[model samples]
Target: MNISPNGINIDEALEALAACTVWYPDYREAMRIITKCINTTRHRKDPSSAMLIGPTGVGKTRLCRMIEKDLGPTQQARNSECDKKTWPCVYIELPESATIRNLSVVMAQVLGGKPTDNQSVVILEDFIIQRLVTIEAKLVILDDFHHVAEKGLTKTKSSLCNWIIKLLNRSGVAFLISGSSSAEETIDLVEELSDRFPYRAKLQPLPMADKASTSVLLGVLASLEKEMIKLGHLKEYAHLTDPTPYKAIYLATRGNFRRLSDLLHDSFEIALLRGDYTLKISDFAEAAADLAFCCCPNYFLMSHSQLNFALKFQTNKSSETAKK
Candidate 1:
């Protein structure tokens, strides 16, 4: 393990590593798709919507954040100075205080769009339309949609989803929805709304044969190493290598990028405290042992053979490519 003068270890500087690597090509593609959707809908007269379906921890939140980051400057400009009045994107997490009335209120606030609560649906609907028209929002991203169903906010969900569709049908604004796979089924229960999401992207786990994916995994660790270096801890550990941390990472996290990151990060800290500059199999072993006790069934039962197969698959592909 190499140590830096700052005593930084793998966990400090690259905390984002513990979340999701935006550098992954697959994840990047998802971001690209979202950006395209924003561009297409931004100028449209009616609203549009998109759905992102994936297992937990495959970077849905990260992708959403990336969209926000990219759109922030233009969104801010629109919010502050645009006479044409457009909302490039407005994001709301569905789990938070999402009653029908409150959700309407929040969306109204975000889009500079109005909520017409004149004690009449007609008045309320008109107010909302006026607000949306005033700002000209291109797309709205509703995240954590699973919470909408879980909270028993069926009417709220219906009203909100319907409102979004109405915006799309009548005003041409696009919506981007992101949630767990369960969310798709939940949304499907409301088929009318689900039909509106013509574009859907489901982020799959990193394929084991994808050197690009595995390499990105190491790239994340290397970033972590830089963090450790900042803490004057880089030299304190051994140079990380093959079967390196990835073995334990792949097994415990099941290629869920977020979970893999969390596992490595939490475990690395424990390993560092044990005073080893070089991370060994034992560092990961202890980490796995701890994870086993945390009630994650997959982590506890991950098969060594499964990991071996993945590694072998990667090796053969590399060899074949080299021969070619």
Candidate 2:
């Protein structure tokens, strides 16, 4: 078994590996758009909202969190002239069963307001608007915006979208909505709301069959390998840039970044358990089966035979283990 000469243990190494965040070109483009939206909204008379639509596991939430971190929290005033805090950006996730009142409550909380259940939606909305103005927030980021469609809240979703349009008109703050592709359905319900969010940015998974996309995916893998080595997570290069493991990962994750990361993390854990520091195509196959069975039951049975054929050199250890 190969081990790191840096003396980092397997557990610690795997932990570090899992915690690393890789920023690719698509994410950077999203960040650029977010920054531009914030700036435009801050200075313009008519505030514009942006929509970030992507499929599940494509790092939509991760991108929003990165923006929030970059903007940081509100800072309190030191001088006596103005004693209010100034929050440049506010971020919140819409509730699964989202309603106007609950959405108000969530926004109020983000703006440092304590909203009670007894408070009327009108009061909460007013309070949220005032707090947003008080803090002088330039941008508002709402994640999981697609949840408005869940539980058949069509009427409520329409009302909420209209309210958001009013909020932007009144508050002069840019609203950035991030959600899955289903979010488009919710937005399209309101014509005005759809028109207001004219700027749309989408994060797409790397295409498995596209040569350019494959090259970019391979580049990401190579960069991740370099990052792990730089962080002392590996004693030597994992050679993830090699065709064997690269193709195996692409097949397993279908070029989804989140799934690829999860697959790699699980494979690293397996390698650690087996006292093998090097990553191999077989490890990814095993990790895919393990992850699919544990978290995605829908894909487990169908993927077993495919995984076996993808890496024909190895016996179906993952399937055998699944039986046990």
Candidate 3:
């Protein structure tokens, strides 16, 4: 692989892959919920919707798309009038300017029509329902439902939620609403919609095992170590995986996969350009200093390299003093 300014090109490639990978358990659960909702819509009379709540970059949107693709065309196979142009899976991002009127316009546009009437808002919503029925859409995923809250339009949020509930109760469209993990915040905004979805799933953060599970995270770091070794920066900073360095990395990232990935990516780039593999205590300190200056303080001020060197130096000085 051609090495870029950021140590190895593989870091970026690995980051991209890691971003898409849904780990093990979350993947299975997400697939199950989506399938259940779609199948329920097809075979049942009173269809209900689901809400997928989680933090940002926790694979919520990706899971939604994956489920939609697996359902295959989203409607009944027997509808001959249904053209491919009419997609069964309609994914809508809640806009910043969310009002009853604008939302109606958005829905109308999604259904391939223009909003042109005194009751255009009503007509747009009805069009969406009818089209969904026509396409036999088993699922309608509304990603970033929290945008309504962020936009400071609680009425619009309530209206949108009400509209969704109506679809679930009447139209048989299963909904999957994604949101953040703060329990209080989630409840405050989506409290009304919660009663409808009895099956609530939370995407828990990855566990950081002491020694056994540490390898899972370390393996990620090891990969970077190997790449940096190849680039000749390992000798100076090779202690990054040593006990001290390992603890430092763990403390700094707090087991957040996205932040961990970003830090490793940037650190490797810095190390490679500096042309040092054996990362010194000063190097880690310098990195930390730079971070603090940039207003991004690492949990620990002293880099592993700095700590290791300082300890070693102190030990030698103490031994010399004892001999004298």
Candidate 4:
């Protein structure tokens, strides 16, 4: 395997990139809002919930995970600490094809109960509610809630809305549901459910043209360079904020956080192979070709290599579709 001048290998450099998290202002604000949501709903008789909307891979799950970590993981999903049973938080991901019955079973199981298919939905839900009270659950997070907006899930959505309201009313346990844009529309369809989810936050792609957003993008890249330096993989500063490369990266990733990370990750692989710590537009351009976001209309301004790779990728994809 190829190695850089500092003897760093591709695996090591890529691992460093993965270890680093590029925090933007919006993500920090969302964290504060969720912290407020937990505290405000803990004492209310009729607890209200919060909803977070963003495209997939926008770090909604990561935010929920930080909430879980702060609350502390429950032992055995429920345990006595200081002579009181407590489960500070619970996180459940809604399957793409979720149903009320299955959701009830999942809740029951998470609360430390053994639920079977044979049990009635009412029985499972009752078990969950009682268990929630016993464990003193403060907040429950349901991710991928956009699935409810899909066609023919009307009955399941109604059932879930009623069930969540019941849990909030009985136990004063707030909820945080997150999904893509469709999750917002689904909430609007149900007036009662929508009312309960008045606290809403959105995650949007960073803008490249704007001065402030561009600064944020550059800052994130600078932080990554620092991380690499601290890891001893970089001896020289990688001036990624420079226009030529930064503009190419912005075009390739469209300011999406996940795609930005991925593009850098792939570029680092090329850097390692070439025994270089500094990145180039050619690296990100080639990396863009390998990404699955071929549907995007925007194209990076680079040599034919990027465009050619994209064209080849599209052709292969079309051929595969024809065969299928």
Which stretches of candidate 2 lie above 4 Å from their native place?
1-6, 9-16, 150-153, 209-214, 232-238, 272-277, 293-324
Q: Give a tens-digit lDDT track for model 1, residues 1-324.
A: 433333544444345445434466666667777766766666554344678878777788878876866665343333355456455556777745565566566665665555555544545555666665665655668787666645665675566667666656765667788887766765666677787665677788754433635466556555655654544343455443345445646545656776666566655666556554555555555566666432243332345566676567756886899999
Tens-digit lDDT string for candidate 3 (179-226): 665322443456656665655555544444447444555655666566
Off by over 4 Å in 4: 1-13, 75-85, 153-156, 210-214, 236-238, 273-278, 294-324
Better of 2 and 4 by TM-score: 2
> Candidate 4 lDDT, tens digit per residue, 44-121?
556778888899767788787888888987754424655555788988888767777777777778777898769998
lDDT of 4: 0.72
RMSD of each: 7.6, 6.7, 9.4, 6.5
lDDT of 2 by residue, 1-324 (tens): 445443447667766776667677887788888787777766665677788989888888888888888888778876758676898889999988787777888888877788887999878878878877888887789899877655455787778778887787777778889998777777778888787676778898865433545376876787777755554544544477655555556666767878877877776766655553455546555676767633343222335455446545323654677789
- Provide the overall lDDT of each model, using Cα atoms, as 2-decimal numbers: 0.61, 0.72, 0.59, 0.72
**Estimated TM-score per prediction?**
0.67, 0.81, 0.64, 0.80
Which candidate has the highest TM-score of all?
2
Question: Which residues of candidate 3, in runs, are more than 4 Å off?
Answer: 1-22, 72-88, 116-119, 150-158, 181-195, 213-246, 264-295, 299-324
Q: Count the backbone clashes (under 3 Å) in each candidate.
A: 40, 0, 13, 0
